[model samples]
Target chain A: MTSAPALVPRPLARARPLVEPALREAVDRLHPWLARIVGYSFGWCAADGSPSATPGGKGIRCALALLAAEAAGGAARDAVPAAVAVELVHGFSLVHDDIMDGDELRRSRPTVWKAYGTGPAVLAGDAMLTVAMATAARTGSRAALGELVGALDWLVRGQAEDLAFESRAFTGPDAVTVEEYLAMASGKTGALLGCAAAMGAALAGARGEAVTAYRDFGRHLGVAFQAIDDVLSVFGDPHRTGKPAGGDLTSGKKTLPVLEALAASTPASSRLARLLLERPLAEGQLTEAALLIDRAGGRRRTEAWAHIHHQRALHALHSAAPLPCPKADLTEVAAHLLHRTA
Target chain B: MTSAPALVPRPLARARPLVEPALREAVDRLHPWLARIVGYSFGWCAADGSPSATPGGKGIRCALALLAAEAAGGAARDAVPAAVAVELVHGFSLVHDDIMDGDELRRSRPTVWKAYGTGPAVLAGDAMLTVAMATAARTGSRAALGELVGALDWLVRGQAEDLAFESRAFTGPDAVTVEEYLAMASGKTGALLGCAAAMGAALAGARGEAVTAYRDFGRHLGVAFQAIDDVLSVFGDPHRTGKPAGGDLTSGKKTLPVLEALAASTPASSRLARLLLERPLAEGQLTEAALLIDRAGGRRRTEAWAHIHHQRALHALHSAAPLPCPKADLTEVAAHLLHRTA
Candidate 1:
């Protein structure tokens, strides 16, 4: 066993049809070629524009939005546009990130950039983003539009910072501090998820404080989710890749664990760094690197951080809506994220 | 002189201060790091972020917006936000285009991509686009938001097509048709300019027909502007770089001349294709390529097309607002573009 169960809460999984039609509609809004490329990127179509049955990400963001609206005592259906807008933005970012990160495959298929070539991928990403704005506008909420724009700005900033972390520091160190990594992660992932949750609350006509609470909850949840995912990439069950592990360690990503081990000020810290610095990480090296990270307390500390964020998210959600309890379902979501058995 | 005067018209020049402040404010809205890069892209800052006296491109898009407002019988001042939004979007596209094209210099200074690196440049472009949307939203018109989004969609589509033309088929045997080139030009340069002009009219509460007329006028003007710029780059006086006129020929851009020459059924067309097929055009080959292109009627036909669009723009403008005449100032603007001489 490597990590947590791959499960979304029942209600979140069931909420798909409520959000997906609108996603398809947003894709349809584009011109034919643009629509075809974007639809393929979203796993809605195969390489030749045929309908695809590929299961996409659990769409946790959409579920968060609908749940937020439901928790606010509003009809979740009314927030469909907001949900669709969130998905479009997410898709846009994924397409661009796949290109920028040189990711060749996604969701068991070739990435948009891999299949359509870089130029078309770029154009498709831009189109998705444009449609996202138009879709958001169609919701007829200027304030929500402003909120999403602000989140997107943070997203870009975070991406810039993330790329910068790849470079050596001006003082000659290439190591990323834990603090800097957290800030970057918050911007890159937390900001957009927080925006999604807040958008849902806003659509439900929740007051400012309630919306902010949802935003904060989503922000914490986003961090928690990323932390668990990073842990899984290092030690989780080999996601059907048929290999024991070839994830973050081989790529030299400075995830939470790596950063923690680097900051340990111990012999294992140097050992972990040495392993990480090797390209074409030798056979058995990824497993070795994981062991070193564990020895340096990187794995446990990261899990504890995830637990802390999960708790914070729950607390914030409680403040967002006290009357109706989503404690059980939301807990289920968190459990799926954190209960790893690696 | 082979073309129009090398000048900005009086009206366009006078509209500078009215538009400049808004541009500065838009820059100020960015995070400090982002602001510095974007401002440098706009030639408002030196490499070290200090203010620079470097002159930027003539604010033709801004002037069009103001002029469109004035033509629609509205005070130009009332359209400041619209103008600012246009400039922001324009800057966003320029930054991205520079990165994609690997352009190292603009306005006699290093491009953002060249100065700040690709990742930062991409982030700045994204930030500028977000700001453009927010700035457009400040105009308080959902209709204009829709208009801008529509134009942005076209912009992406055109860019995709333009990039596609760089392939062998489009530039070689399959040879991009004149119509295809026109459509690409319309999207690449015309859509945003047309959007800017129509945005100005729409901001002024112009009727639907009036706004549409302004949009058509701007689209025609954008195409005409691109056509003349293509011609100038091939034959007009060389820029301050002191390089002889080998700009487009050496790059093998599928410009009006190249496309026209390719479409021609003659020995010279074959000769032009052979020359273009060279891996790196020889030092003396660019001049020969230019002559072959001209002999194939590329230059004359392209100029005629520009003139036709120019007439259409004037016709559309006249239809947009008949009550108040902007005949002289608008003519000067047109002349400056169409009659450019070095």
Candidate 2:
């Protein structure tokens, strides 16, 4: 079990100071009301427009962008705009996703749509997306812009699929397959991470095969990250994850572990499947479901899946042939992300 | 009064055949459910994904793009991507705007959100915007991409302002002013039109001054077009406009006519102000409000504003030094747009 202090990798620490100022400046370009709503999303302010105590996201994507730039033989500062743009896009997705999922909490506070009205939250999400495109365009790299837009398209498709999957039966021919889950996970999470790495490399004047390899590395890494998050959501401490234990099960989200559990034909797995369909599950039922998933080997299978992707990510990173120091930093960051408790 | 037949300007008729196929192709790349929702937005399908009899938007922006390209010494076909991209963006805005304004109808059909659910409509709008950005980026012109992004930002800002204005008092100092309405109108409408024309020229290999002049022409034309729309929402025949008469007043939209009416200090205007504060106005009250606005000179003033922008548009078009045939076609199109009854 890694200590909380160890979660902040040196690369993330280095990248945060460089990226936060640029992110703030870009957000300030939005309409005042929109800026306020978006600011809350970033943990910069409370719902009342006062400073907040809660810290924002981990800045993993920003660090990845800057590190990719350095690995591609450009200074980290060259990818500041790319970093800000990716963060904005990520924030935009969370704001809208909460509305779509009707989730009321995020980052230990009310979601954007919960704090503001749905209409204003929708507008804030749109404003963030608009600013992201504008910020990316300012980089003046056609290839980078193309990558960002491509990722955005995939991200939207991924979200649409995720929402569509919720109503699907837990067991049947209509059930979501593990393969389908992987594809959705790639599009929803991997695409933007891939774009962040690709944009960083492209902005650093890296071309062709090297950039492709970097993108591949990031995509695989993103899948691993999501898998870890899926595990933590059900099994980790609620205080650390900032979500109730087994929240995803109660919400009926089709995460990898649940899908894996259903694939298992054991009695425990069958009982787990039945429990999930009777959603708004009691806390005790949620506990039973989690235990059933573990009993059916779903937890181990999901962990193995994450490890497989981690290996693939490392292979792609080696192919990218990054600069020695940045390569080492990226490795450390990757490890932290994959092994973090929250 | 210009008839419906004359409203289909020659350029628009020509551009539609080229643009629609490409537009359909771009939309086909979306998730199946999203494509269906977006197709509904284009009047190409019904809520159940069946074909529909309703006609789509006029493709006015598409025509402006194609014509601007030809004017810049490139073939109109050279700007097909630009035309398609701008129309995608226009459709995107309409889908989202309907949600924000809580309007249930557009183009004589149920609005996207009204037909589908709000969540699906939001996803569909996002998909269209993503496709638009990808299409513009495919043109491989950084300047054109910049123009498109700038317009999107302005469009978002304009919408935020318009939404914020709805809660403001109609008579107090917080009342939306004429100047504020014009600025919002330019952002809400002019920015995209300007982007359409500018992107067309940029893609046609036109440089600095020519592209700027074309953009200016489209921006002013957009303001004129919106001014006409404001008047029609108040006074146009329901059968022709495909909306209830005085619908904007009933919805409490702060359009140019309403702002002008509020600015006036006449007896009719004072009563109209009082009437407006009681929203969800009755049918008879709406009719009386329209009459009061007309008696207070709002209709005449709004028409004058439209004419003023019309002159400004033509002046900018002349300065663009378009080829003779394209110049004549654009001038005719401008006249039809400014003078159409519905």
Candidate 3:
């Protein structure tokens, strides 16, 4: 097949210039040392404080916030605080999640805990979260601030469950079920994105069903995005993603694909479950496990779930009845998020 | 001097019944595991999840919030959310502080990170903070939420500076100065107390100068409380405090007493500086350092500073011109805070 066009959403570039400066200013309120750590986390600088060539994560949440505000009949610039708050929260969660997961790398760079000590990394995460709240409060919008805090509550709860899953049995009643897995993903990956959209709408003076629609839109999109991530982590090219293939499998992460595969209960699925129960996968076993998972229809089932959620997200957006230009912008961004290789 | 009357303030009893229920409700929103860890930190339960008999801290900050509201012509019950928010923030800070300081013990029991793991403790702290913001937002007062967020920012900044001090030289240009130490204490301890008072008043609809007065009152009182705590940590009777005397000294904490003594630059202070530079303080070195600090007028200077701040706090309270009954209650609490033995 011919190569598809690139999936860069125009809204991201549009949002970056507005959100980046505000994000930096919020982080600047932290102590100089903490600011340095957070800056590194944002890919603004290297570990030693020099400017970095590597770019930060796509400001997808920021773009969503800006577009949501615009769609709700407010200027995108008016929602800059919402964009900054969500971005700070996103960075904070990543930093803490890395420490919790004991993952030492992100985007091919050392994780905050690996580069700085765990204690400093902990402080850095705390600083970012505090900055997020302070930035959100600056908007003088209680609804926006409430949305941010609610997302935080869900985020931490989700993280706690995700960690607990690591110790759970791979099979039987005590094992993590698919429903439990989806709930965890909704909190872990979805809540902040939901907040990003909801806060933007709220800041724009949108209330009632419209805000809910935007929240649902972002939440469903987040789940879809996470589902895609699970597939790419095991099956995509390492060169494209800048991460090792099957690393999640070797690390024993309870991704949607693996959970779905185990639920299938076919011969391959049974073997896959038993294989995962081993404390550490032996060399080349990761590839074998991936193959078994794929054979058991894990990849296809996961993709189907992604597609379902992706469609639900679009439906939510359509129900929101946003301004035409920003609605189209949001649709383009959502499609890109679903299709991105990295 | 003859023994003085006990320093228990009646406002604590009044505040507890109202604040505790709200605080528990907020904490209940966390994941079960996180709630358990946080419960242990709050002295509400043991490591094994059984209820604990040990009474928690006096909830001074909570009482402050309640009294501030009453003093500002609002019912104390009206500020329970503010009271609960400050208490949660206080507990959150302690959990994270224990991990950051690597202190294994608190109130003669294992710290949260010591009983649970560090990662869980980190999540517990985050849970409490999220609950705090949520609780504060439930007040539906933007000013109150803003105050709480501002205090969190200060709390984290102070903690970062306190950790940075551990690696700084004990003397010369690189040493932590008295001003820096006070500033850190203000952020670390004063900010939350200030927020408690300010938020209560704000929620009470007391604007402008009354809120500022309450904030300054609590801030000065908190600094004074910290000064006294620094002195007590070194010299207080272990039986009464339920902690080892001179633990702070052995830990090489850059508290007010030590900072004052070092600033004196006397021969004893110079000797104290050299003795501290040795890693893993030798046996009896703690008592020696305490004595050297005392001989250099550190103890007196610290006490004098505390007295000054205490007086300033009372003056600010008087300037606020709150209602007569609550003002009297606040004065009683302030006196207890300044003079408490433990």
All candidates' TM-scores? Answer: 0.89, 0.97, 0.97
Q: Please give the lDDT score at residue B81 for candidate 1.
A: 80
Task: Report RMSD (Å) for each prediction in the order shown.
Answer: 3.5, 1.7, 1.8
Considering summed lDDT, which 10 consecutive residues are worst modelled in model 2 chain A? A1-10
Query: Can you list the residue pairs that collide in candidate 3?
Result: none
lDDT scores for all predictions?
0.77, 0.87, 0.87
- Per-residue lDDT tens digits for candidate 3, residues B127-231, read 888888888877888888888988888889899999999988778989888899889988999999899998998888888799999999999999998998898
| TM-score of predicted structure 3 | 0.97
In model 2, chain B matches the true chain B with a TM-score of: 0.97
* Clash count list over all predictions: 7, 0, 0
What DockQ does candidate 1 score? 0.46
lDDT of 2 at A290: 90
Error of 1 at A35 (Å): 3.1
Determine the TM-score of chain B of model 1: 0.94
Better by DockQ, candidate 2 or 1: 2
| DockQ list for all candidates | 0.46, 0.76, 0.76
